[model samples]
Target: MELDPKALALFKEGYDKIIEGIKTLGFDVTDENFADTAARAAKGLHELIHDQTQVRKDVDALLAKTFPAKYTEMVISKHNTCFGVCPHHLLPVIYRISMAYIPTEKVLGLSKLSRLARLIARGPRLQEDLTHELADLLHVNLASQGSAVYIEGLHMCMAARGVGAHEARLVTSGVRGVFLELATREEFIKLVVAPPTTLV
Candidate 1:
Protein backbone atom coordinates (compact mmCIF):
# COMPACT_ATOMS: atom_id res chain seq x y z
CA MET A 1 0.00 0.00 0.00
CA GLU A 2 2.45 2.55 -1.19
CA LEU A 3 1.42 6.19 -1.22
CA ASP A 4 0.85 7.15 -4.81
CA PRO A 5 1.75 10.54 -6.25
CA LYS A 6 -1.85 11.68 -5.98
CA ALA A 7 -1.95 10.98 -2.26
CA LEU A 8 1.44 12.51 -1.69
CA ALA A 9 0.30 15.70 -3.34
CA LEU A 10 -2.51 16.08 -0.80
CA PHE A 11 -0.36 15.58 2.30
CA LYS A 12 -0.84 19.09 3.64
CA GLU A 13 -4.42 19.09 2.49
CA GLY A 14 -4.93 15.89 4.41
CA TYR A 15 -3.73 17.58 7.58
CA ASP A 16 -6.22 20.38 7.05
CA LYS A 17 -8.87 17.79 6.48
CA ILE A 18 -8.11 16.31 9.87
CA ILE A 19 -8.36 19.73 11.46
CA GLU A 20 -11.70 20.31 9.79
CA GLY A 21 -12.87 16.88 10.85
CA ILE A 22 -12.05 17.68 14.45
CA LYS A 23 -13.68 21.04 14.18
CA THR A 24 -16.87 19.51 12.83
CA LEU A 25 -17.07 17.54 16.05
CA GLY A 26 -17.10 20.80 18.04
CA PHE A 27 -13.41 21.03 18.81
CA ASP A 28 -11.48 24.23 18.28
CA VAL A 29 -8.40 23.68 16.13
CA THR A 30 -7.43 27.36 16.25
CA ASP A 31 -6.73 27.11 19.95
CA GLU A 32 -3.14 27.30 21.12
CA ASN A 33 -3.36 23.92 22.79
CA PHE A 34 -4.10 22.29 19.45
CA ALA A 35 -1.26 24.01 17.66
CA ASP A 36 0.91 20.94 17.18
CA THR A 37 -1.51 18.09 17.70
CA ALA A 38 -1.89 17.32 14.01
CA ALA A 39 1.82 17.23 13.37
CA ARG A 40 2.39 15.04 16.41
CA ALA A 41 -0.33 12.66 15.29
CA ALA A 42 1.17 12.48 11.83
CA LYS A 43 4.56 11.59 13.22
CA GLY A 44 3.07 8.93 15.47
CA LEU A 45 1.22 7.30 12.62
CA HIS A 46 4.32 7.44 10.43
CA GLU A 47 6.27 5.64 13.12
CA LEU A 48 3.58 2.97 13.43
CA ILE A 49 3.85 2.13 9.77
CA HIS A 50 7.59 1.63 10.07
CA ASP A 51 7.68 -0.68 13.06
CA GLN A 52 9.48 -3.49 11.24
CA THR A 53 12.65 -1.49 10.72
CA GLN A 54 14.89 -0.02 13.42
CA VAL A 55 18.40 1.31 13.83
CA ARG A 56 20.02 -2.09 13.80
CA LYS A 57 22.76 -2.91 16.27
CA ASP A 58 26.26 -3.64 15.04
CA VAL A 59 27.90 -5.97 17.55
CA ASP A 60 31.20 -6.69 15.82
CA ALA A 61 33.29 -4.06 17.58
CA LEU A 62 31.64 -4.62 20.95
CA LEU A 63 31.90 -8.37 20.68
CA ALA A 64 35.56 -8.09 19.86
CA LYS A 65 36.04 -5.97 22.93
CA THR A 66 34.23 -8.17 25.43
CA PHE A 67 33.58 -11.69 24.12
CA PRO A 68 35.69 -14.89 24.46
CA ALA A 69 36.72 -13.57 27.85
CA LYS A 70 34.19 -15.58 29.93
CA TYR A 71 33.09 -12.76 32.26
CA THR A 72 29.78 -13.37 34.02
CA GLU A 73 28.32 -10.50 35.96
CA MET A 74 24.75 -9.25 36.42
CA VAL A 75 24.69 -6.18 34.24
CA ILE A 76 21.57 -4.19 35.01
CA SER A 77 20.24 -1.06 33.41
CA LYS A 78 17.35 0.13 35.48
CA HIS A 79 14.91 3.04 35.52
CA ASN A 80 15.11 3.79 31.84
CA THR A 81 12.12 5.98 31.05
CA CYS A 82 10.16 5.28 27.88
CA PHE A 83 7.44 7.25 26.11
CA GLY A 84 5.51 5.73 23.22
CA VAL A 85 2.06 5.50 21.74
CA CYS A 86 0.07 2.35 21.34
CA PRO A 87 -0.26 1.12 17.77
CA HIS A 88 -3.90 0.14 18.15
CA HIS A 89 -5.37 3.38 19.46
CA LEU A 90 -2.50 5.83 19.31
CA LEU A 91 -2.78 6.17 23.05
CA PRO A 92 0.13 7.06 25.28
CA VAL A 93 2.05 4.27 26.99
CA ILE A 94 4.72 5.35 29.42
CA TYR A 95 6.79 3.12 31.64
CA ARG A 96 9.99 2.41 33.48
CA ILE A 97 12.03 -0.52 32.24
CA SER A 98 14.56 -2.52 34.19
CA MET A 99 16.75 -4.86 32.19
CA ALA A 100 19.41 -7.16 33.48
CA TYR A 101 21.57 -9.81 31.97
CA ILE A 102 24.27 -12.03 33.38
CA PRO A 103 26.84 -11.42 30.72
CA THR A 104 29.02 -14.30 29.58
CA GLU A 105 32.24 -13.16 27.93
CA LYS A 106 30.53 -10.17 26.24
CA VAL A 107 29.24 -7.03 27.93
CA LEU A 108 27.85 -3.86 26.50
CA GLY A 109 28.50 -0.40 27.80
CA LEU A 110 25.64 0.38 30.18
CA SER A 111 24.54 3.27 28.00
CA LYS A 112 24.49 1.03 24.94
CA LEU A 113 22.09 -1.31 26.68
CA SER A 114 19.75 1.63 27.29
CA ARG A 115 20.22 2.70 23.69
CA LEU A 116 19.12 -0.72 22.51
CA ALA A 117 15.92 -0.49 24.56
CA ARG A 118 15.06 2.95 23.20
CA LEU A 119 15.75 1.82 19.64
CA ILE A 120 13.27 -1.02 19.78
CA ALA A 121 10.70 1.08 21.65
CA ARG A 122 10.47 4.37 19.71
CA GLY A 123 7.83 3.30 17.22
CA PRO A 124 4.25 2.30 17.92
CA ARG A 125 4.45 -0.79 20.07
CA LEU A 126 2.77 -3.29 22.33
CA GLN A 127 3.75 -3.68 25.97
CA GLU A 128 4.45 -7.32 25.32
CA ASP A 129 6.83 -6.53 22.48
CA LEU A 130 8.60 -3.78 24.37
CA THR A 131 9.42 -5.99 27.32
CA HIS A 132 10.25 -9.12 25.40
CA GLU A 133 12.48 -7.42 22.85
CA LEU A 134 14.67 -5.94 25.57
CA ALA A 135 15.06 -9.36 27.13
CA ASP A 136 15.53 -11.17 23.83
CA LEU A 137 18.38 -8.97 22.62
CA LEU A 138 20.11 -9.07 25.95
CA HIS A 139 19.90 -12.84 25.84
CA VAL A 140 20.60 -13.50 22.16
CA ASN A 141 22.89 -10.67 21.17
CA LEU A 142 25.05 -10.68 24.28
CA ALA A 143 24.82 -14.42 24.78
CA SER A 144 24.00 -13.79 28.41
CA GLN A 145 23.77 -16.65 30.85
CA GLY A 146 20.51 -15.11 32.06
CA SER A 147 18.41 -12.11 31.02
CA ALA A 148 15.34 -10.43 32.46
CA VAL A 149 13.26 -7.44 31.45
CA TYR A 150 10.27 -5.99 33.28
CA ILE A 151 7.95 -3.21 32.17
CA GLU A 152 5.22 -1.52 34.15
CA GLY A 153 3.09 0.77 32.03
CA LEU A 154 -0.10 2.72 32.19
CA HIS A 155 -1.93 2.30 28.90
CA MET A 156 -4.30 5.07 27.93
CA CYS A 157 -5.70 3.00 25.07
CA MET A 158 -7.97 1.10 27.40
CA ALA A 159 -8.69 4.00 29.69
CA ALA A 160 -9.51 6.85 27.34
CA ARG A 161 -10.67 5.11 24.17
CA GLY A 162 -11.81 1.59 24.76
CA VAL A 163 -13.97 1.76 27.86
CA GLY A 164 -12.67 4.88 29.56
CA ALA A 165 -11.46 2.98 32.59
CA HIS A 166 -8.43 4.78 33.95
CA GLU A 167 -5.64 3.70 36.26
CA ALA A 168 -5.19 0.35 34.61
CA ARG A 169 -1.66 -0.98 34.41
CA LEU A 170 0.03 -3.38 32.05
CA VAL A 171 3.06 -5.35 33.08
CA THR A 172 5.02 -7.60 30.78
CA SER A 173 8.34 -9.31 31.05
CA GLY A 174 10.61 -11.73 29.23
CA VAL A 175 13.20 -14.15 30.52
CA ARG A 176 15.89 -16.23 28.88
CA GLY A 177 18.78 -18.50 29.85
CA VAL A 178 19.20 -18.61 33.62
CA PHE A 179 16.34 -16.19 33.97
CA LEU A 180 14.24 -18.89 32.36
CA GLU A 181 15.37 -21.56 34.78
CA LEU A 182 13.39 -22.13 38.01
CA ALA A 183 15.33 -20.66 40.92
CA THR A 184 16.68 -17.75 38.92
CA ARG A 185 13.26 -16.78 37.67
CA GLU A 186 11.86 -16.85 41.17
CA GLU A 187 14.57 -14.58 42.44
CA PHE A 188 14.13 -12.19 39.55
CA ILE A 189 10.39 -11.95 40.15
CA LYS A 190 10.95 -11.29 43.79
CA LEU A 191 13.38 -8.54 43.02
CA VAL A 192 11.04 -6.94 40.54
CA VAL A 193 7.92 -7.05 42.68
CA ALA A 194 9.23 -7.02 46.24
CA PRO A 195 12.78 -5.97 46.72
CA PRO A 196 14.28 -6.84 50.05
CA THR A 197 14.30 -4.14 52.69
CA THR A 198 17.64 -2.39 52.96
CA LEU A 199 18.71 0.33 55.32
CA VAL A 200 20.10 3.25 53.42
Candidate 2:
Protein backbone atom coordinates (compact mmCIF):
# COMPACT_ATOMS: atom_id res chain seq x y z
CA MET A 1 0.00 0.00 0.00
CA GLU A 2 1.19 3.49 -0.81
CA LEU A 3 1.63 5.80 2.15
CA ASP A 4 -0.08 9.16 2.11
CA PRO A 5 2.52 11.86 1.50
CA LYS A 6 1.14 14.08 4.28
CA ALA A 7 1.08 11.26 6.80
CA LEU A 8 4.57 10.19 5.80
CA ALA A 9 5.87 13.69 6.38
CA LEU A 10 4.22 13.78 9.80
CA PHE A 11 5.70 10.41 10.66
CA LYS A 12 9.14 11.60 9.59
CA GLU A 13 8.85 14.57 11.97
CA GLY A 14 7.86 12.24 14.79
CA TYR A 15 10.80 9.96 14.04
CA ASP A 16 13.19 12.92 14.15
CA LYS A 17 11.94 13.74 17.64
CA ILE A 18 12.27 10.09 18.61
CA ILE A 19 15.87 10.12 17.40
CA GLU A 20 16.55 13.11 19.64
CA GLY A 21 15.00 11.23 22.52
CA ILE A 22 17.24 8.26 21.78
CA LYS A 23 20.25 10.57 21.94
CA THR A 24 19.24 11.56 25.50
CA LEU A 25 19.45 7.87 26.35
CA GLY A 26 23.11 7.94 25.16
CA PHE A 27 22.57 6.04 21.91
CA ASP A 28 24.95 7.04 19.12
CA VAL A 29 22.52 7.88 16.35
CA THR A 30 25.50 8.70 14.09
CA ASP A 31 26.72 5.13 14.28
CA GLU A 32 26.58 3.40 10.88
CA ASN A 33 24.51 0.51 12.24
CA PHE A 34 21.97 2.90 13.81
CA ALA A 35 21.81 5.37 10.89
CA ASP A 36 18.52 4.04 9.54
CA THR A 37 16.94 3.04 12.85
CA ALA A 38 14.54 5.97 13.04
CA ALA A 39 13.29 5.52 9.49
CA ARG A 40 12.80 1.77 10.00
CA ALA A 41 10.89 2.28 13.24
CA ALA A 42 8.62 4.90 11.68
CA LYS A 43 7.92 2.65 8.71
CA GLY A 44 7.10 -0.27 10.98
CA LEU A 45 4.67 1.75 13.09
CA HIS A 46 3.04 3.17 9.98
CA GLU A 47 2.38 -0.32 8.71
CA LEU A 48 0.71 -1.22 11.99
CA ILE A 49 -1.63 1.80 12.21
CA HIS A 50 -2.16 2.80 8.60
CA ASP A 51 -4.57 1.43 5.96
CA GLN A 52 -7.44 0.81 8.39
CA THR A 53 -9.83 2.05 5.68
CA GLN A 54 -8.63 -0.64 3.30
CA VAL A 55 -9.02 -3.24 5.97
CA ARG A 56 -12.64 -2.23 6.52
CA LYS A 57 -13.33 -2.44 2.81
CA ASP A 58 -11.84 -5.92 2.73
CA VAL A 59 -14.11 -6.95 5.62
CA ASP A 60 -17.18 -5.65 3.84
CA ALA A 61 -16.27 -7.66 0.76
CA LEU A 62 -15.69 -10.78 2.84
CA LEU A 63 -19.06 -10.44 4.53
CA ALA A 64 -20.72 -10.15 1.14
CA LYS A 65 -19.60 -13.70 0.31
CA THR A 66 -22.06 -16.01 2.08
CA PHE A 67 -24.02 -19.13 1.28
CA PRO A 68 -27.50 -20.28 2.20
CA ALA A 69 -27.79 -22.68 5.08
CA LYS A 70 -31.15 -24.29 5.86
CA TYR A 71 -29.96 -25.93 9.08
CA THR A 72 -29.41 -24.28 12.47
CA GLU A 73 -26.22 -26.06 13.54
CA MET A 74 -23.42 -24.19 15.22
CA VAL A 75 -20.20 -23.43 13.32
CA ILE A 76 -16.94 -23.12 15.21
CA SER A 77 -13.52 -21.90 14.10
CA LYS A 78 -10.64 -22.15 16.52
CA HIS A 79 -7.00 -21.03 16.85
CA ASN A 80 -7.32 -18.00 14.60
CA THR A 81 -4.14 -16.10 15.44
CA CYS A 82 -3.59 -12.35 15.09
CA PHE A 83 -1.37 -9.53 16.28
CA GLY A 84 -2.57 -6.13 17.50
CA VAL A 85 -1.29 -3.01 19.17
CA CYS A 86 -2.55 -1.88 22.60
CA PRO A 87 -3.86 1.65 22.39
CA HIS A 88 -2.89 2.42 25.98
CA HIS A 89 0.80 1.52 25.71
CA LEU A 90 1.42 1.06 21.99
CA LEU A 91 2.73 -2.40 22.81
CA PRO A 92 2.03 -5.59 20.91
CA VAL A 93 -0.71 -8.04 21.85
CA ILE A 94 -0.83 -11.61 20.58
CA TYR A 95 -4.27 -13.12 20.22
CA ARG A 96 -5.72 -16.57 19.67
CA ILE A 97 -9.40 -16.29 18.91
CA SER A 98 -12.16 -18.90 18.74
CA MET A 99 -15.59 -18.16 17.37
CA ALA A 100 -18.92 -19.93 17.17
CA TYR A 101 -22.20 -18.99 15.54
CA ILE A 102 -25.59 -20.55 14.95
CA PRO A 103 -26.61 -19.56 11.48
CA THR A 104 -30.20 -18.62 10.67
CA GLU A 105 -30.42 -18.86 6.87
CA LYS A 106 -26.98 -17.71 5.70
CA VAL A 107 -23.45 -18.53 6.80
CA LEU A 108 -20.04 -17.08 6.04
CA GLY A 109 -17.39 -19.19 4.34
CA LEU A 110 -15.32 -21.20 6.84
CA SER A 111 -12.05 -19.48 5.86
CA LYS A 112 -13.80 -16.13 6.04
CA LEU A 113 -14.34 -16.61 9.75
CA SER A 114 -10.58 -16.89 10.38
CA ARG A 115 -9.88 -14.05 7.97
CA LEU A 116 -12.46 -11.94 9.76
CA ALA A 117 -10.81 -12.58 13.10
CA ARG A 118 -7.45 -11.38 11.74
CA LEU A 119 -9.00 -8.42 9.92
CA ILE A 120 -10.77 -7.18 13.02
CA ALA A 121 -7.59 -7.54 15.06
CA ARG A 122 -5.66 -5.04 13.01
CA GLY A 123 -4.65 -1.69 14.60
CA PRO A 124 -4.65 -0.57 18.24
CA ARG A 125 -7.53 -1.93 20.32
CA LEU A 126 -8.42 -3.38 23.70
CA GLN A 127 -8.80 -7.13 24.06
CA GLU A 128 -12.18 -6.85 25.76
CA ASP A 129 -13.54 -4.56 23.04
CA LEU A 130 -12.14 -6.75 20.28
CA THR A 131 -13.90 -9.81 21.66
CA HIS A 132 -17.27 -8.09 21.69
CA GLU A 133 -16.75 -6.64 18.21
CA LEU A 134 -16.26 -10.09 16.70
CA ALA A 135 -19.38 -11.43 18.36
CA ASP A 136 -21.42 -8.45 17.23
CA LEU A 137 -20.23 -8.70 13.63
CA LEU A 138 -21.22 -12.35 13.39
CA HIS A 139 -24.57 -11.89 15.08
CA VAL A 140 -25.59 -8.64 13.48
CA ASN A 141 -23.83 -8.56 10.12
CA LEU A 142 -24.47 -12.19 9.29
CA ALA A 143 -27.82 -12.25 11.04
CA SER A 144 -26.89 -15.38 12.92
CA GLN A 145 -29.21 -16.77 15.56
CA GLY A 146 -26.36 -16.42 18.05
CA SER A 147 -22.66 -15.66 18.05
CA ALA A 148 -19.85 -16.08 20.55
CA VAL A 149 -16.18 -15.22 20.70
CA TYR A 150 -13.40 -16.41 23.03
CA ILE A 151 -9.98 -14.81 23.02
CA GLU A 152 -6.68 -15.54 24.74
CA GLY A 153 -4.34 -12.57 24.63
CA LEU A 154 -0.76 -12.11 25.72
CA HIS A 155 -0.24 -8.41 26.26
CA MET A 156 3.27 -7.00 26.07
CA CYS A 157 2.38 -4.14 28.39
CA MET A 158 1.48 -6.60 31.12
CA ALA A 159 4.47 -8.80 30.51
CA ALA A 160 7.16 -6.15 29.95
CA ARG A 161 6.15 -3.51 32.45
CA GLY A 162 4.45 -2.73 35.77
CA VAL A 163 3.81 -5.97 37.66
CA GLY A 164 5.64 -7.87 34.86
CA ALA A 165 3.57 -11.01 34.94
CA HIS A 166 5.31 -12.71 32.05
CA GLU A 167 3.24 -15.86 32.18
CA ALA A 168 -0.10 -14.14 32.50
CA ARG A 169 -2.64 -14.31 29.68
CA LEU A 170 -5.84 -12.29 29.48
CA VAL A 171 -8.88 -14.32 28.44
CA THR A 172 -12.12 -12.66 27.43
CA SER A 173 -15.44 -13.80 25.98
CA GLY A 174 -18.57 -12.34 24.43
CA VAL A 175 -21.92 -13.89 23.57
CA ARG A 176 -25.05 -12.72 21.73
CA GLY A 177 -28.56 -14.03 21.10
CA VAL A 178 -29.06 -17.78 21.74
CA PHE A 179 -25.49 -18.08 23.00
CA LEU A 180 -26.76 -16.32 26.13
CA GLU A 181 -28.48 -19.58 27.04
CA LEU A 182 -26.66 -21.44 29.82
CA ALA A 183 -26.40 -24.79 28.05
CA THR A 184 -25.34 -23.29 24.76
CA ARG A 185 -22.65 -21.20 26.40
CA GLU A 186 -21.33 -24.20 28.29
CA GLU A 187 -21.11 -26.25 25.10
CA PHE A 188 -19.05 -23.55 23.42
CA ILE A 189 -16.74 -23.39 26.41
CA LYS A 190 -16.28 -27.14 26.40
CA LEU A 191 -15.47 -27.26 22.72
CA VAL A 192 -13.05 -24.36 22.97
CA VAL A 193 -11.15 -25.89 25.86
CA ALA A 194 -10.89 -29.36 24.40
CA PRO A 195 -7.39 -30.45 23.41
CA PRO A 196 -6.58 -30.66 19.72
CA THR A 197 -6.27 -34.17 18.32
CA THR A 198 -2.84 -35.40 17.32
CA LEU A 199 -2.28 -36.71 13.84
CA VAL A 200 -1.09 -40.29 13.64
lDDT to native, each model? 0.69, 0.88
Model 1 backbone overlap count? 0
Candidate 2 structure lDDT: 0.88
Best candidate, TM-score-wise?
2
Candidate 2 on 1-200: residue-level lDDT in tens? Answer: 45656666677788889889988999988889777676777777666565778788988999999999977899999878888889998888889899999999899989999989888886789999999999999999999999999999999999888575988989999999999999999999999977667769
lDDT of 2 at 31: 86
TM-score, candidate 2, is 0.90
Q: Cα deviation of 6 in candidate 1 (Å)? A: 13
In Å, residue 24's CA in model 1 sits off its true spot by 0.8
Q: How far is candidate 1 from the true structure (C-alpha RMSD, Å)?
A: 5.1
